[model samples]
Target: MSDHPILFLPGPTEVDAELREIMARPLIGHRSAGFVDDVQQVCQRLKWLYQTSQHAVFESAPATALMEAAFRNLVRPGGRTLHLVCGAFSERWSKIATDCGRKPELLTVPWGMAHDAASLRQKLASSPTFEAVCITHNETSTGVIEPLQELAAVVRDASPSTLILADVVTSLAGAPLNFDAFGLDLAFAGTQKCLALPPGIATYALSHRALERARSIEGRGYLLDFVRAVPETEAGKTLATPCVPLLWALRAQLDRIATEGLARRFARHIAMQHETLAFMHQWQIEPFVADSAARSPTISCLKASGRDVRQLAENATKAGYKIDQGYGDLKGKTFRIGHMGDHTVARLQKMLAALLR
Candidate 1:
């Protein structure tokens, strides 16, 4: 029916038709009263979604930009930050920190595995005081969801002063993350994933402690300066012109999420996860992540089981679907099915049925 196949990759999930229409409406001035009100409302809703009382703000950039901003704002030059690397996204954060000219120490587990709290505790004990600890809540490439709540507790007990920075790009909205309750200093995500919106914007929640840290850190750049964004964000304005259409689409999507209720939305995602697992079993393929506890409810990575994953993806595209063959080093060895955002169990069942055919 359409030239472009429906997306079932890890990110840039399918958008609702209603939201597309909303984005197409006439543009609005970023500084106008109506736009300001929209910005305020969106932030408030985001706090509800993140389950945090901390300050939430957005920038006209991708999630990686926010990752770099976190390093610039929280870690001083030559200050050490610990990165927990288990997959591509987590490894990317460490590189971003190094690119910022900060000292980063990495604690890596094998790919397709979760970082253990015990190992993290031991690592923190052996290392000097860190300025921050970077974690990827959900590894999109590996389809692993680390035990964030437990890991945060380990950080609190072992290194109370260290800021806990989380990249929740593929986990937000589709997973259970209570920022303030879990004691996170910073959590960031791109809307193109679970928020069911288009790319080009990223949102983050910053605690009071993080703001204080940003105030103390020098050389924080102009565009992504966390300290500079506060005053304007508090007054319901952005530092510069934002992608206005995405905000309009975001507001509408938030309303849809509100109607569904956060708990229900999370339950829906879990259901999709189970459905996908059943589909995997039917095909006699196993999940990449062996531990059921660590498997992501948003994306499922399955071992190829002697199948041609690249050709499978090509067939899927020809059949009007776009599926992930794998990511980075795992390509052709494993494939991923993104079941987050507005996708439901019924919809996933239909897709799985088609694949079966």
Candidate 2:
């Protein structure tokens, strides 16, 4: 048995044995011809998953780094940014914008609730034009998935030129996202979540319009510069040395994803969500996101239903599983079960049974 508890957390999900073995291979220099070819191939394959024509770039950082990159590259210093906040991660984006010296205008909804397109339409009609509107496709903290396609349309109708930047950290591989079809200027995700890889790497793709916006903007620092990185990525290169091992693991996993079929993968996630929901029902617990349509298929936040969620988490730990007690203010009142990544219904059922036991 492995020493570390199996991860059932929202991120840094279990890297399967195949990927682990792939990572064990000797590392290659990021600048090598072979590595460049691998990057190019992986980027092309990634387009299949993103369902977009735009090529994706791999960065040796967490998804939050790319969140900051979106601001620095797309928005001018202190530019007006409209943040749609419904949960912790969305709120974090607003805080990051503030930390970057931008006075972000937030359209907040209750936690565990989703931002509706109608409210966004009203807000955009009344407010001044924003440089960009930040949106979280899936709120990992609350297990709420925003209606991004609808919101994107509302943005185009109300504020045509305003860039739509999305954080798909928990939705990328497991959810259906058509970047080009939805008219998203930029969409990004970390590998740890639904991609099922270990933490420390992120991938992102942006539209040509966003690239033009980045070129027009200044103060778009060195490391995360979209103008510098996008072109290089198109040519199978990166601005800096990437996490080579993770890149290898990503390539293997992308291949696995292709073999499994993207539609099949999505169906698998939905099945897992149903299985988890059924288990929660049996326990007489309810999901924190009351509206089923708004709930994330990747992570399920269930109310503790008067149970000690902290102790429940500890019990899972003792049983050689790692589970979330819940996040922030909801700590004892709710608990989370991450059903994304490489996890399947059967495996999740086993874990659910173990937790209940």
Model 2 score (lDDT): 0.89
What lDDT tens digits, residue by residue, belong to model 2 across residues 199-282?
888889888889898998888889889888877876888888888888888989999998898899989998988998988899
* TM-scores, each model vs. reference: 0.98, 0.97
Q: List the residue pairs that clash in candidate 1.
A: none
lDDT of each residue in 70-166, candidate 1, tens digit only:
9889999889999999999999899989999999999999999999999999999999899999999999999999999999999988999999999
TM-score of 1: 0.98
lDDT of each: 0.90, 0.89
- How much is the lDDT of residue 12 in candidate 2? 72
For candidate 1, which ten residues in a row score worst on lDDT? 348-357
Runs of candidate 1 with Cα error greater than 4 angstroms are 1-4
